[model samples]
Target: MTCPLLKEDLIFNLTQGLGYEERSLALYEEFLTMLEGKELSAEEIHDKEIIERIASDERRHITIAKRLIVIAEEYYHTT
Candidate 1:
């Protein structure tokens, strides 16, 4: 059976360079773990507020990966 999470286009784009789907999957899995453990600080949740350094660091990698998929689909026709 295929893993539903692995089927996402974002996961596909991130893993393309690595050539190992498991690497991307592992990154997102860790991201999910971080998100599950807490509510963001009031300051961190606002669009105009500067995100805390620690919180930004925690989310940056996955956000980059997700952006890659959007870029691919929107500009490169990867999908």
Candidate 2:
């Protein structure tokens, strides 16, 4: 038998993490849009690169969270 409380907690946490990552990804995309067509200094360019990398990571995190949620749901339902 699956523990209802643990399953609920896992789903909730995964949902929250997904929301956070999505919001962060949106903000990063907006910032990148704002940077478009602007001449950047070397440091600014480096910072932008870092931001892009982080945004990529956020996207990965979102995917992982979604997958986990699905797996958790399926596991709980089956068990």
Candidate 3:
């Protein structure tokens, strides 16, 4: 699934590298909390399903954030 944060520049900055692991995990936890509290938009609902699937795979925020960090690192490297 495509990350909702992929288009968010600030989130990109926050999860840019392995050095920010703690912060990244915190951010994702906050994001999940926010998501859980509201009636999701159509897109968000779709994303939520995807997130649930991934989460059920035993992938926690730290693992997801680490992957995002790797992607962000590659992005920074290219541009």
Candidate 4:
């Protein structure tokens, strides 16, 4: 039998990671907005590119987290 405690812990960790990713995504989006319509130096432009990449990663993480949560919940109930 699957351990309910393990499942609960997994869900908790997943939830935490999901929240962190969401917050990170929001901050990155806000940073991008702040950069919009502004003249950026070469270094600033590079930083923006990096931020964009990180933001994309965060979005991917969020999607994965959501799917995992659903799967975990299903397993939790079925066991």
lDDT per residue as tens, model 2, 1-79: 5565688898999999899999999999999999999999999999999999999999999999999999999998888
Q: Once model 3 is optimally superposed onto the true structure by TM-score, how far is the C-alpha of residue 55 displaced, in angstroms?
A: 8.0
Winner by TM-score: 2
What candidate 2 gets wrong by more than 4 Å, as runs, is 1-5
Residue 21 of model 2: what lDDT?
A: 96
Relative to the unseen true structure, what is the Cα RMSD of model 3? 11.6
Off by over 4 Å in 4: 1-4
Task: Write model 1 residue lDDT over 1-79, tens digit each, in one string.
Answer: 3334434555565657434434554654566566555776765455223323434553565566566666655654432
lDDT of each: 0.51, 0.94, 0.61, 0.94
lDDT of 4 by residue, 1-79 (tens): 6654788799999999999999999999999999999999999999999999999999999999999999999998897
Q: Per-residue error at 49 for model 4, in Å?
A: 0.5
Clash count, predicted structure 2: 0
Predicted structure 4: lDDT: 0.94
Give me the displacement of residue 39 in model 1, in angstroms: 22
Q: Comparing candidate 2 with candidate 4, which one achieves the higher TM-score?
A: 2
**TM-score ranking, best first:** 2, 4, 3, 1
Q: How would you order the candidates by lDDT, starting with the best?
A: 4, 2, 3, 1
Better of 2 and 3 by lDDT: 2
Question: Compared to the true structure, candidate 3 yields what TM-score?
Answer: 0.36
